[model samples]
Structures are given as C-alpha cells and as structure tokens.
Target: MQKLLEIKELTVSYDHEVVLNDVNLTVHKGDFLGVIGPNGGGKTSLIKAILGLVKPSKGQILFHIPQTRIGYLPQINQIDKRFPITVLDVVRSGKTDRRSFSLFAKQTEEIAHAESLLNEMGVWQLRHKAIGELSGGQMQRVFLCRSLMNRPELLILDEPDTFVDNQFESELYEKLKELNQRMAIVLVSHDVGTISYYVKTIACVARELHYHPSNIISTTQLASYNCPLQIITHGDVPHTVLGLHDKHQHDHKHDHEHDH
Candidate 1:
C-alpha cells in the first residue's frame, strides 16, 4: 500500500479561468481509483495536471516513481483519428523514445513487445488497418495496448469507456483489473454504475474535491456535494442520494447553459 502519487492543494486553470480548486488526493500501488463527475467538472483538467500536460496553477503533484514508470491513455474523444496512421503504427508510436527504428536489430525486441500487447488487447488482427476505420471500442483498445507496451507501473486513463458498448466497457474494466495486479490505475469516468465493480476506491470531483474511501458513499456525503450524484458498490447500479426530481431540475439548468 505504498503511496504512488500524491496531489496536495492542487489547482488548475485554463485561459485564466479556474477549473480545479484545492484538490488533494493520494494513490497507492495496486489501487484502482475511479474519478467521477458531470461533464465540464474539471475531471480531464485534473488528469492533465497529474500527467504534467497542464501546469497546476497552485500546489503540487508528487510522484513516487523511484522504481516505477508512468503511462497515460487520454480520452478517446480527445484523440485525433484523422491522423493517417495504422493501428500497428499507433501502438508502435508508444516506443518512440526507445532506439530508432532504422536500427532493426535493436528495435526488434520492442516491436515484438508491442505486437504482444496488441494481441493481448485482442486487436492484433486489425494491426495493419487504418486507425480511422476501426470502431470506437477497437480504437480505444489499440491505444490501451500502446499504453501497456511500456509495462507501466502506474496507468492513468481519461474516460476509458467513452463511446464503447456495455460489453466492451466490461471487457475494458476486466482487463484493467487484471493489469491492476501489477500497476496502479487512475481512471476518469462518468459511468458511475459500473466503475465500482472494478475500482477499489472513488474520488468524486466537481469545482472542489471530495474523497470517499469506500465505493459505497453515504447520503450525508452526497448531500455535502450539493449536486446530483450517486455511489456504486459491489456490482450494484448507482443509487441516488438526492431525489430524482431535484436531479432532473439540476440537469435542466445544467443543459440550458450549454445550449447558450
């Protein structure tokens, strides 16, 4: 249960607008942390801050990677499928930092490793296919394989289940759980009903931060969030801590702003 990553009073902003505020959390080895929130709730921003893709406006993200490596899989929606790349090429891209491809003898081992990861993700058959041709699930699996190619000690994923069907979502979580045996995983997901079955802990984010150790959060804690929310536990669907009418009203107001 060694701490793998720690965020202390972390804050992030975009274009001078504050997104994350005073966020604090810690991740441990073998931990599966599910980050859940409504859209535009700064979930992606927090992940970006953790990956060093976005600089925190305040505070720090400390990594205990003295003997470990970090790998990241960004949200599927954020990826540019228009790139003229093949599935194999995308997976191989994960090894760009290694020996140059011109030295075939030196890169042979890395190529084989990438192929094995692709096969493990069940996408090796589409290795030569264009990335744009694959379904959303297939594309996600391809990137997931690429992330695993490094044999990471910590894996961070942003919205790993977006655009995927239920079956593939289940498969993805199962594979992630298997991977968690060797590496800690931190995932940003909105699918509250399914995340608890696979993840060991939950971190609910909004404009602020709330930490829940158990997948089953209490009604009091949910009330403290003062927003439409629920908790999942032991394969059960999320049950609302707030009334349905209130949630619907809140959703309407939330949507109205987006329409503008």
Candidate 2:
C-alpha cells in the first residue's frame, strides 16, 4: 500500500481553454485504477499531465518512483502504423528511455524480455512482421508487449480495449488482472462494466475528477460527482445505477449487471 504517485490541485488548459481543474489523486503500489468519463471530459488530458506530456497550468504531480519506472500504452488509433517497424523492434524500443543497465547484458536481457512479453501477448510468431501489416487487434497486443518490456512499476493504458474483438477484450482484462499482482495500473476505459470487474477503484473525470474509492459505484454517486456516462450493461452482475436522461428528463434506470 505504499504510495506510487500523487496529484495535487492539478489543472490543465490549452490556449485559455481549460480541460482539467483542481484534480487530486493518489496511486499506490499494486493498485488497479479504472478511469471513466464522456468524450473530451479531460480523461486524456489528465493522463498527459501525469506523463508530463502536458504541463499543468496549476498544481503538481508527484511520483514516488523514478519516471523511468512508469510505462504507458497510448490509444492504438493514435499510432501511425506506416513507420515501417517490426513488432519485435517496437517492443525493444521501450527500453531506450533507460540506460542504466550494462550495455552487453542489457541488450541480451531486453531482447529476451521483449520476446517473453510478445509470447505472453501471443504475438511472438508475428515478431518480424511490419506493424502496418497487422490488424487492429494484433497491433494492440504488440503495443501492450512493448509497454511491459521495461518492467515498469506503474503501467498506464488509455482505452486499451478500443478496436478489438470481444475475445481479446476478455483476454486482455484477464492478463491485466495477472499483471496487477506485480505493478500498479491506471486504465482509462469507456467499458465500465468490464473494468469494474477488474479495477480495484474508480475515478470519473469530466473537466474535474471524482475519485471513487470502490469499484462498485451507485448511479446517485456518479450523478453527485457530475460524471454523466451511459452505463452499458450485460451479464449476471446486478446493481442499480441511473440511466442517462436527456433534457426531457424521463425516469429510467440502468442495471450495473456485467458479463463474467
């Protein structure tokens, strides 16, 4: 339960347009945090701030671990696949950010580690393939491998479930659960139902951040937090949250049942 990262009064703005305001959060060792919100709700902005990609206009983000120990998997669609890189090379690049290890031993160890990650992701056979030639799902798996190549203490994934099949989604979550035993994970996802089953805590971001200490959140709770998102339900898990209502304000309820 040691603290890994902490954010204090964080605010982000672009050209006078504010995206995030006064957000505070803390991550601990072996934590699995799920981030959910509507589009343009500052979810990505918050992530960028944490990764130091975007300078916060106010407040600060503190990391107990070295920045090099943090791994990031960006949204797959953001990657330009035409870069003419092999899947294996892509994963190997993950270690370029750090150079403390012995040169000779590092290359050999990193290559071996990269291969293991690829194998675990079921893409070792496609190691030599050009990234552009792979399908969306394959690309996702490869990036996932790349992110873990550094053996990071904290792994951050932004909408990792996008553009993948149901099977891969299920498999990915299972794999994440396994990975969570070793590292803290911050996952930004729209699929609340799936993440709720895996993430230990939840944070709803919408121009502001609402840190829900438990994965199980009530609709009233979401409303009170000012986070409005459509709850997509499926499966046997049962809980009652509120349904998304328009300006018309019709009374409707959403069941937080999830597929196992």
Candidate 3:
C-alpha cells in the first residue's frame, strides 16, 4: 500500500473560472480508486491534473515516477468516430509519442505488443476494421487495449462505461480486476453503484475532496463525502409520512385530496 501519487490543496481553473478547489488525495500502488460525482463535478479536471495535462493553479501533485508510463482512456463519447482510423492504427498511435522516428524504423516489437493487447481485449478480429465501423462497446475495448500497450504502472480512465452495455461492462470490470493485480487504476465514473464492487477506494469530488474507504460507505459518510443530499427510501411510502418538507406543502394537499 505504498503511496504512488499525492495531491495537496490542489486548485485548478479554466479561463479564470474555478473548477477544483482545495482538492487533496492519495493513491497507492495496486489500488483501484473510483472518482464519482454529478456531471461538471471536476472529475476529469482532477484526473488531468494528476496526469500533468492540466497545470494546477495552486498546491502540489507529487508522483513517484519522474517519467511514469501512465495509460489514459478518455471518455469514448469524446472521440470523433469519423476520423477514419483502423483499430490497429489507433493502437499504434500510442507508440508515436514514445518512439522516435528513427526508433520506429524497425518497430516490429511495438507492433507485436499492440496486436497482443488487441487480442487480449478480444478485439483482434477487428484489428483492421475502421474505428467508425465498430460498435460502441467494441470501440471502448479498442481504446482500452491501446491504453494497455504502454505497459503502464498507472491507468487512468474517464467514464469507461459510457457507451458499453451491461455484459461488456462486466467484461471490462473483469479485465480491470486482472489489470489491478499489476498496476494501480484511477477511474472517473458516474456509475457509483457498479464501481463500488471493483474499486478499493472511492474519491467523491464536488469542488473538494472526500475519500471513502470502500463499499462499506455509510449514509452519513456519503453526505460528508461531498455527495449531494438525496433521500433514499427502502419501500414505497407517502412523502408526508417520510417527513420530507416541501415549500408548497404538496404532501399535505395530496393527503387532503385523497381523504375526500
């Protein structure tokens, strides 16, 4: 459980508009950390900060590796499918940033690694297929394979399940579980209920930092975790009976109408 990354009082802004404020977090080796919150909750910004893609206005982000092999799988929805790129081409792009033109002159090894990753993700059948031709789930798997080609020590994914179905999601989680045995993973997701089973730690972000240990999260702890206040009920019951107050007093009016 050695610390791999640490952020202290991190603050990020875009065009002078504050997005993240006083954020703090710690990630350990072999940890599966899930970041959950509503849309526009600065989850992506936080990940970018950790990856050194976005510079924090204040505070610090300390990493264990000066040249870390970090893998990134951005939200699939953000990708332009009309780019006319093949799956193998997409996976090969991962090496372009690391391999120099001279080094790539004889890059059979890199090509083989990319093919192996595609096969591992069960997408080798579509290696030559155009990215736009693949289904959403297939496209996600392809990107995941590309991310893994770097042999990263830390993998960061933003909304990995956006376009995938339940079955594919299950497969993705299984792959992630296997990958977690080798590298630490940080995932930003809105699917909190599903991610709880896979992630060892949860970081709830909403203009601040709130860490939860795991699935044993309590209602009070959730509230303190910067999660919005939501009244959860076990069974169907009248709102009036639940003691939830409404400014218009609609529950009382509904009860009065029903009594007639």
Candidate 4:
C-alpha cells in the first residue's frame, strides 16, 4: 500500500512536560487505524501533533499529499453551541482550498459535493438550520459531512462516538468502514472492543506508541504496551474486559496499598 503520512520520532510537550515521546507511526492508503489508550495517555496529543495544532518538540510529520487533503472530525463537545454558523456553511467551510466567503459567492462543484455529503448523511433537510439547534447525533452527522466535503485522502476523527446514541454510533462506524474503501482513516477512541471490529489495525498510545498490525488485540498485549484501558462490549448483555496485570505490577500495587 502507498504511504499517506509518516511520523518519525515525533515528540510533543506541554509546559515542559513530555506528552508524546519518540512516537513513530505511518498511515497508508486504505488504512483504518484505531487509536486507543487511557485518558491523558497522549492519544489526543498525538492527534494534535498530526493535525499541526500543537507543534512537535522533535521529529517530523511528512504528508505525501497536501495538508488540505486531510479531513478532520473533532469531538462534538469541543464545538461551541453558540456559534451562529449554519449547517450548510459549516460543511462548505471544509473546502480549505476555497477562499473565504466563496462558500456562498461561488456556485462551484464543491457546493454540490457538500450538499451530496449532507444528503448521504441524512442531514440535507437540516442544512439551513443552525448547528446549535440540532441534536447530538445530528450534529455529529453534520460534522462528518463537513469532513467529507474536502474529498480528503486521509480522514482523522477524535472520539467520534462521544455524546451519540448506540444506534448512531453503530451507524457511524459502518459509514466509516465504507469510507475506508476510498480513503485512509485515523480514529481515536477509548473503546477498543468496538473499534476492533471495524479498524484494520490498532495503535496503543501512552506517552509512547505501540503499533499493532492487526485489529484483534489481547488484554495481555495491551498491558505489555502499557496501555491500560477498560474495554466495553456491546450486545444484549454488555460486559467489561479489564487489562491483565502482571505479578510485578500486582505486587507493586499491593505494596503501595499497604504503604498507604
């Protein structure tokens, strides 16, 4: 497969503290990579680095295609509801190549593409409505449509499942699977069990990164990678899978408990 993005010895820091340490990763064409880790485990940091939101303290991020070709769907909570932007405008804004205000002034093919994506996402009817008026699921769908407006070669989503119902989540994952047929995807989620079903590969990020070539990962492997997370399974009867703790870790925990 052709390489889309490459991260070489990437390091990101905040206020003199290292968030990501020597992380190396490669995203290839048609790759669906699921990023999983505990909260504050540098998963978001890595995404920020890739998106150029936070400059890396060291290393390089090389994109085979122009940065404008990368699409992003941020966590819904990060969006300010007070923003007065309409759904149609939001989606049209995703065309980074277009100059400001051209979204409305230009009746180009990009506008049609944006509308097509909204229709596909079942939000075409709500295009005129303000994004704040939409439900969480609707907002997510709108944002997804916006991300697709750019016709990106690589799509990056941060916690796309947050604040959405189970049905929408399932639908979103299925849609993403379909999108992967055309472009590479980097999905950041805390749910390992769920993404394991859709993603082609996995990366465990906790200050450092461990790339697992297969989506199917074991609790032992997660522990070895130092990525301790609670895995939730979805079915009629949902269950949880905890990370396996080794004797050394268990003993250390026990000793610390006894000390306190």
The TM-scores of all predictions, comma-separated, are 0.84, 0.90, 0.83, 0.88
Please list the C-alpha lDDT of all candidates, in the order they appear: 0.77, 0.84, 0.78, 0.85
Candidate 3 lDDT over 1-260, as tens digits, reads 68888899999999988899999888888888888877888999998898788999999988885334788999887899999999998998876346445665638777898899999999999999999999989999999988877788889999998888878887898899899999999988886656655777778888787876553334455566667634332222222222322344432332312210
Model 2: how large is the Cα RMSD against the reference?
5.6
Candidate that beats the other on TM-score, 3 or 4, i.e. the better one: 4
Q: lDDT by residue for model 1 over 77-104, one digit each (tens)?
A: 8889899999988987776445344677
Which parts of model 3 are misplaced by more than 4 Å?
96-106, 229-260
Ranking of all predicted structures according to lDDT, beginning with the best and ending with the worst: 4, 2, 3, 1
Flag the better candidate by lDDT, 3 or 4: 4
Task: State the displacement of the C-alpha of residue 69, model 2, in Å, after optimal TM-score superposition.
Answer: 0.7
lDDT of 1: 0.77
